[model samples]
Target: MNTVQEAKRYLDNAREILREKAHKEEGYYLDTKYVKMAGHTAYVGVLVALDGLLGKKGKGRKGVDWYNQQLSGLDKRPLRSFVGAYDTLHLSMSYDGNPLASVAAAGLAEAETIIKWVESRTVEA
Candidate 1:
């Protein structure tokens, strides 16, 4: 499968992780581990879609800054979405393990926005 398809699959898996594993109660996920896993899965999906659009770097992994610089040259809208996704999915949820369902929803929305943007620019792989 192509990068976009793989990325979408990652997103699907992330959602399943949250729905099936992360126990939601009182508007919050009770399991931090599942939340973190879902967040990381979704974040990687965003990166995978971006890599398809922007081309993958060789060797060492690139940071968000590099992505920002490259995306800034392309369009400001996706760049903005990328920033939100990075902060919400990567930092708040993935690293800090935020359990807020609303926060995860927002982050996922932002991830979707970026993925859709990438979709517009790329053909199926």
Candidate 2:
């Protein structure tokens, strides 16, 4: 599969995991493990989308820090979304046992938005 296809696959996988595994009926996730897993999964999807975008510009795969730096120079909306995912979903869960449901939900939404934005800029393999 191509870059976009790969990114979409990751995004879809993250969405499924978030909906099925990370979801909680109490309005917030109680399972720290699932929260961390979901965050990591969604973060991976964001990275894949970033790779797709950078690859299109003749850039090779880079670290998360590099991606963040690049994102800082791009559109503010997606950059904000990316930052939210990175901060709340990707990193914050490690230190917090019970992350708020709104935070996780927002992270997922941001990731999905980033994936969609990347998809819009890419073509099928």
lDDT for each candidate structure: 0.93, 0.72
Give the top-scoring candidate (TM-score): 1
Q: Which pairs in model 2 have colliding backbones?
A: none
lDDT of 1 by residue, 1-125 (tens): 98888988999999999999999999999999999999999999999999988887776889999999999999999999999999999999999999999999999999999998999888553
Tell me the lDDT of model 2 at 51. 80
Q: What is candidate 2's local distance difference test score?
A: 0.72
Each model's RMSD to truth, in Å? 1.8, 3.5
lDDT tens digits by residue: candidate 2, 1-31: 8665776676677557657776676787656
Error of 2 at 78 (Å): 1.9
Best by lDDT: 1
What are the TM-scores, per candidate, against the unseen true structure? 0.94, 0.76
